[model samples]
Target chain A: MSPKGKTRIRRFSPVQRLFHVLLMLSFLTQGATGLSRMYIETSWGKGLASVFGGYESCLTIHKYVGIFMICWFLIHGLYLFFKIDWRQFPRSLFGPDSLLPRFEDLGQAIQHVAWMLGIDRLLRLDRWGFLKKLDDFLLRITRLPPLNRVSYLKEFDGLLSVITKPPRFDRWGYWEKFDYWAVFWGIPLLGVTGLIMAFPLFSTRFIPGWGLNVVFWVHRIESILAMCHVFIIHFFIAHLRRHSFPMDRAMFEGSVDLAAARHEKPAWIARLEQTGKLESQLVAEATPGLRALFYIFGYAAIAVGAFLLIGGLVNSPSITW
Target chain B: MKEAVTRVRLVYIGGAVGLLIGLAVILTVPVRLARGQEEVTSKIYRYRERVATGYYEGYEVSPRRARAILETPGIKRGLFPYGSSSAMVRIRARLPDSHKGLKFYYRNTCIECHPEQARNIHSVRAGITCRQCHGPEPIPAINHYYSAMNTIRRHSYVCAKCHEGATAAFASFYVHEPPAASLETRESFPALFYTYWGMLLLLVGTLAFFIPHSVMVGLRELSEHLSFSVPHTLMVGLRDVFKKLVFFMSHSFLAGFRKFSQKLSFFKPQNFLAGYRKLFKKKEAFKNETDNAP
Candidate 1:
């Protein structure tokens, strides 16, 4: 079939899809239940508690959700080890293809924001543009080493030479590297602290009262950061960024429209064109059933959250040590 | 790609090995520590028994009663034997309404043994004995029966008398310190006030703001990206809804009040004034533009 006329909708591998689904569920449960516990005196807390049967029940759900989230984190790390190209990972850090902030990126950010507010005309930038650059920076700073190291560049280069002939590498195509490390470190901080709070046995055994208090502080702060980042930053980039607004299916379909690939990720587009597998037309179609399900779940979550807030405020139960 | 694969495999193996070792240590360490704790606890129990018996012998009360007295609640086994005895005596006093107010004879026997403690027992008259309260005759059957019941009855009240007043037993035992105020007292009000404020802050942060904010943000994002297939979109949407609901519930009263106030005509005037000012300014700008155009 000719690439210009064909519709290509390649689905994500089952494992990847499963991981994404599980991650979304776990994060939602954790954020909701955790907020409820923290604000036990609020009406929302009470309502949430009522829906979950009681305060203890909501807490139990939150605890298990945290565990599941950590499990997903570990699984993701393992998957990265098996699937990712480590040689390409390190080289993408410092090269122009890297997501590391460039002098122009700062100016681009200002311009983008101005455009969003209708102050300036939009500028056509690279695939992972200014906003993505910021996201990459934040993810990099947040992550620990091994996943975010330039030290591996030499080894990666040596390996690359042995495997295949050299080709021009994108200076900024470091999504896999950034995403892998973000998951790696983010999970441990969230998971370890969450486990400590959920199961006092571990906290009591290894940590004293002061240590537990420190964990509480860190966990609470980290949760705030995670929620804010996911809600504002991740949401803006994944769905609200320029033409990608409304929805983007690259994560699920593992393919982009040739136009989107050409504009946003020219390197990937060129590769696709060379391979003669580029999808020409992009259709923005959402199944009715899927859309309905989204609305149902969305409204349901809001209703439950409101209930917890009310319950927490009205019946502020005394916490006995 | 091959090197990437190798590195990836190494991480997997390392992670698996680390997890296995951690799991093994977590599982085995607790059991070993518990066994050690069991041995230590047994030794401590034996030592406590010996100390308790020696302390009980020092008191003038019957050895049997002394052993039984500490078993009651609120009486620490070794620290206060006389207080324990007094508790037993008070319970015996309260039992029978028919018996003309029972007299507790603390002076004669207690004073003879411990002169210092005798000086503090002002409630007791100069001359009294165990028989004074127990009816002065050694009826073996009644004595034995009353002895068992007295330990149970006097346990709380006798402890209270010395532990209650300006010069309570507990006060005297320490350096005559005043008892701390109860939760309802003026002294406790500050703590309660702070607790209330702390709870208020927590409520505002978690329920009123954070949960709702999370849900709203999540839902708004989910709405924008509605193309993701079933379960994925549904899951994110559900989470968003939950957070919003929690936020609303947390701040219902505040929300209701805000809405009520916003609806009033008095509050509406400010908005009207602002709008009129903007309209007037726009008219003046238009006039300037027309004048300049000519």
Candidate 2:
């Protein structure tokens, strides 16, 4: 229950974590440079362009960053595929070992809903008693005008229950699979469009003028989507949700202990217990120095992303150097 | 285990084969371009040329892609790159009387054959048009007129024509200069197609994977009580649909189809993938042990 007795287990390797840091930086750089060019009329865009030494320099930066993004994405992918054990490959997808969705995830999802609704506790109540009366009273109160003001809290809490609740990740649940595959899937799109946009002259030579226009829209929309997704959705899931707000430098600190693992990834912990690998996988608590670094890097990135998102939406005119 | 290996190989090979087939198709079958030349003018969707009619300030619009300065409302035309949208403040001030004009709306009514129809103002030259600035300059007889990049003496005069026109002067609306048209006509087609479709497929795949979970998560009211269930989300949805299908199959007037259902079930990957054997066999073994219990 306390921090002292908590056990630690490794998630991402050093190489993987390093790649992630590089990825985050490259993506952020690419996004900043690209957006500046996209909305040069706006302050943020103009500021970025100026900071990077004008539009041409920004373009040069964007092109190089894009290439770095593509190269690293490839290296990460190849690293993954290089170690794919043919025998265990099947499990690597839908099995307990992989991030891919599987049938077991379905069971986990339903169970999570039960946990979310506190239905296990609810089920212990009698049908036509005080609990039902309480339920009826609450439901009726929801219809009243005065009480309706606070009734939104009920619905909001229901939604937050899903977000705030610790996920019991059995191996790789659908949500984790989603996050993993988001990078897996997004790399190609970000890479391909970034490449084309980088070499517009080379690309336009073969494609129709209007076709380039199409790529232009796709690239623009996709970039915005990626930015918004990372800023809002991914950030919320990874860091800002109730249990893990301000920072969740699990990536930086490098592991989750047995106590944290039991709550967050119960199925994984259970499997570890079943397989008798619990004590072996235990990592020591993180150093205060590393924790400080996580705060510096993690919170800094989150703050930067949030600022960019807000500034872009508001069309801030003075958002630059 | 074998299934995973087969599936991985299938995916890699399938991807390669798909790419090769797509390339072959694009190469062998020439691009059937609309060229925006064929007569698309109609009575319902009238194609009125805005500049030619000289109602430049009003509703007199045109359908010509090559020479069209502005387009008429309710018309299905290839050109109309100027997204037809303007800021509300700017509109309420300058185009107040002309603001009620319907031509600003996009008509995806004929978008399938005419995909360029899907493009709105935001897409074209930062959502403004040549006519909006230069005032209905004639489309040059040659596409090469605008083909040369950096060849033309740069001027803010064209920009001032619109941005500084009788309306308000925008803070800034600078855009990147277009690349040389020679390069555009040659290299752009494949590059555009690849990036556009590639991202589109990735988006679609993400959605396909995401939606089932979202939908299942949405059914929390039911799942909360039904703690032990077969599956959640897509699998459950599919099961419900399959149940209905089976029910209909058995009840329908055609009796032969009922017998075919069991035979057809064997072809389904889900039969094994669901790990039903784990559920049933475990249950049976549990039952046998319980029967042996005193």
Candidate 3:
């Protein structure tokens, strides 16, 4: 069969797919319940609290769901460690296969922003009005590093570029790497501080001064960052991207449609075919039932998440009590 | 590439705008104002003057209330033992005074709104016992925090709310002169007004703006790229620090048993020599027994 045909390309395996599904459910639950607890004074919060059987039970749900998510991550990490050969582990910082990020990505990001701001127009130089030219000049001046480019991240152009780019991934893009690793950063920060808040009296007994109080704020602040980053930013990128609108079922079905695989991970696909490992990389298509399940859950989550964020923002979610 | 970047640029523009808006809001808006902050410095000065002049003399304890308060055990045997700061303040207010003594007493959060007053009170009263300074009279008042009748804090009735029972638990401590006495004479405390505003800006700036993006991202980048990690290092260090703290706190009584425990060393030369000598004697005895048997 020609590789151009609609051959299913295995993306996430069964374990990985299960992990993703479980993670989605648990994370969504945790985010919802946690926010409700914080903003318990709001009407939605009051409704949610009652729906979850009041404040204490809502708290219980958030805690256990968080623990479950952590466990799922640990399982996924351990599986990857044991299942992959140590030599084949993704280690390079920047390459065709690596997510370590490359200078090219930095350049792509800068180019992308320039195009967005219409600075990259070919014929705009002579047509430039005074203010437009001033704007261009200002942008250029602000773009310069404070010092003679002694640092890769100086003026954080690299970081800004990285932040701006959606994970229009081939192999793994910058944002994909961030998505993969951010949990590693967020989990401990969230978990320990969360646990501290979870068992405040016990923690206060052992920890001194305003330690538990600090933990309380840290937990709230970090959780808000994590939750917002996931619900708003990651949602837009992963599910609502131009190419993957409505939803991305790549994670749920454990495979991407052949064209998607070719578009996004073209190099991976080509390498697999060249090495005669394409068959090994192929997987059965998601059944109608599974597809239905994916959509049902995915769209439901999207709706709930959207509702929570939009309503919370507009209403200024708060707890009076 | 241009199209891809244009799309990317849209995303960037959106995020940047969001960040800027959050920053602007955080910087421009103050998160909180002191409870009763007003532009009436003269009112505060007038109130302080009334406090200094000693508005009314209601220290005389009646036999009836003294008996009642004495039986309560928690109430101290002193002036106003049977009543709270609110009651005494109300009494002072009702007293015939040319000043607004009653209005000041019933007024909500004069000191509460004054960050300068709050800060001064905190510093001056840090290690001092509240009872020693305010005298162990009425056990302050059980202040209801929410929905005050007139003020933000029910405890705004008097200084005794914080100071009265603060030192009751401690047996040996000297009370510094009340902060108002020394602090009222100085004019520099109002400089703390700016400090309060600065704090509001900082809190909003960090939590609402800076921490939301810059600090969070900086921390993330630092953790991933840089070898230094806040969580990794803080957790391990905290655990060790806790263990050491617990050990010392638990062993405080055992200090008498080993007066120089901190200086005592298990790696002493005498101890090592004793063990070495014992081993040497046992080896010699074993060798002689083996030779005899052969």
Candidate 4:
């Protein structure tokens, strides 16, 4: 098979793909049912609510889906715990493959913003030195060694290699790290507040009389922020980006085009090839039928997300003004 | 492999149908309330029983009725021409001579039995006299008192009558009592008060930073991807978005119709029996094959 046709990079494991599907399903369900109740006064919200059998049913579905999400959230944590070779210990957490943010991610984020703003073009300055100093300072505070990017590029492919080489992010981008942690931060807050609100009488036994009010506010604000972030920012980064327009199949089929991987994740690709693990990572490309299924699921999720965001904004008080 | 894919698709269809049926069943189910207080207390009304605790055996309406009436609005202003607070003056003004022309008279007979309750804070504040809450006629309360007290212990039952919007803020909590007197006051629940403020700040701070960051990123992408001066590029981008929306809507509509038709076909007796037999028969055949292999 031609190298271009070969799916030689496994971007996601089958387990990870399964988790993604579950997350997508639960998140979309939660968003749809949640926004329906939140904006029930609006026509769109009302219509959506009636589809789910009115306000009471929306509440029921939201609660049940929320419980499901929290369960999966805990399960995901356990999955990660079990997957780790304890021998790798702290390395599993701090290593290049880790989702945890590192000093280099800050440099990458800065570089990205600089590139986006055209600041990088105006200055041929050794911006790396400045970033390295910042990274050193961060290291001093965080007490973690800087991650070294091991490149295995046998033959550099001109401009693609040059641009991707500068900020050689390993496995995960800084934004991707932010995306992962945002869920970590959000789920617990939403879950705790949701549970408190779910079982208020029990909660009130320990919480003060006014504790329910506080819990209510936290849940509302956090959920709204979450919906906006996921529907707009996360959606744009994951699917609507130039490279991944239409969809990012990596999370679905568990691989990306080796050529595309080389261009976008040069460091990760190079390391895999250098370690001679590249062949092991290879898998057959998804069949057309499977691809069709993925497209249906992906687009449905995107539509629901868009509906929630647009429907919410339509009735927002600020928009009326 | 093709058959496996078909089976997967069938499973998806069956799952969705099952979900819809489940939802229908749940929505149609009647709300079953807890047994009424009268039933719990064995048919004898609590107040009607000869009980003394340094207070009159106050006979208000049933718990359910009081709750329903409390939920009712504008009753205070409409019912009490002379403010509910000054029940004494209003009752005296309607004394003997004035009673002849009045449509309804204050039943001062209640205070005769329940004098101490008349001095209670809620009654005094709302100017609620006996008939105001107990009703001008006792017949309705007596009839329905045994039916149910479903609304009394409901979260925000009393407060929701007036504070409808605030009640919804914590509707999921399913609380059984009125809000605490302290509310958000720091003096009573300092920890909660601070946590609330902390959460508010976190929410505001995160959105403040991230929203602008997202906007900047969006703008940068637009600038990088499309040259706005070229009208063709803009047109192409918009056309792509429109095409996507059209494709999605039409595809979903068709898929829905297909599923509906499949469901309708499933109702056919032959198809139903065929499916049932095929499922179990295949399992049985597999069992025999395994037994023969061993």
Highest DockQ model number: 4
Q: How do the residues B80-184 of candidate 4 rate in per-residue lDDT, one tens digit apiece?
A: 556555654443322323233334445546566456445442354334454443334421221132211122222233334433432212222323222222343
Off by over 4 Å in 2: A1-6, A110-168, A316-321, B1-294
Estimate, for each residue in A160-250, the C-alpha lDDT of model 1 and write its tens digit: 3333321222323333333434455567987887787565433433332223344554566556555554554444445544334445555
Candidate 3's TM-score: 0.48
What tens-digit string does per-residue lDDT give for candidate 4 at A257-309? Answer: 67666766778878887898787777778898999999898888889888888
- Find the 10 residues in a row with the least total lDDT in model 4 chain A: A148-157
How well does candidate 1 score on lDDT at residue A184? Answer: 54
**Best candidate per lDDT, number?**
4
What DockQ results for candidate 2?
Answer: 0.05
Q: Report the C-alpha lDDT of model 3 over A151-261, residue by residue, as the tens digit.
A: 533344454444454334356644566676667777877788777667543443344213433344456656666666676667766564333545678888777666666
Of 1 and 3, which scores higher on lDDT? 3
Specify the CAPRI tier of model 2. incorrect
User: lDDT of candidate 3 vs native?
Assistant: 0.52
For candidate 1, what is the recovered fraction of reference interface contacts?
0.00
DockQ of each: 0.03, 0.05, 0.01, 0.07
Task: Give every collision pair in model 3.
Answer: A41-A319, A93-A100, A112-B5, B93-B102, B108-B151, B130-B163, B130-B167
Docking class of 1: incorrect
What is each candidate's fraction of native interface contacts (fnat)?
0.00, 0.07, 0.00, 0.16
Tell me the number of clashing residue pairs for each predicted model. 52, 25, 7, 2
Q: Best candidate per TM-score, number?
A: 4
Worst 10 residues of 3 chain A by lDDT: A204-213
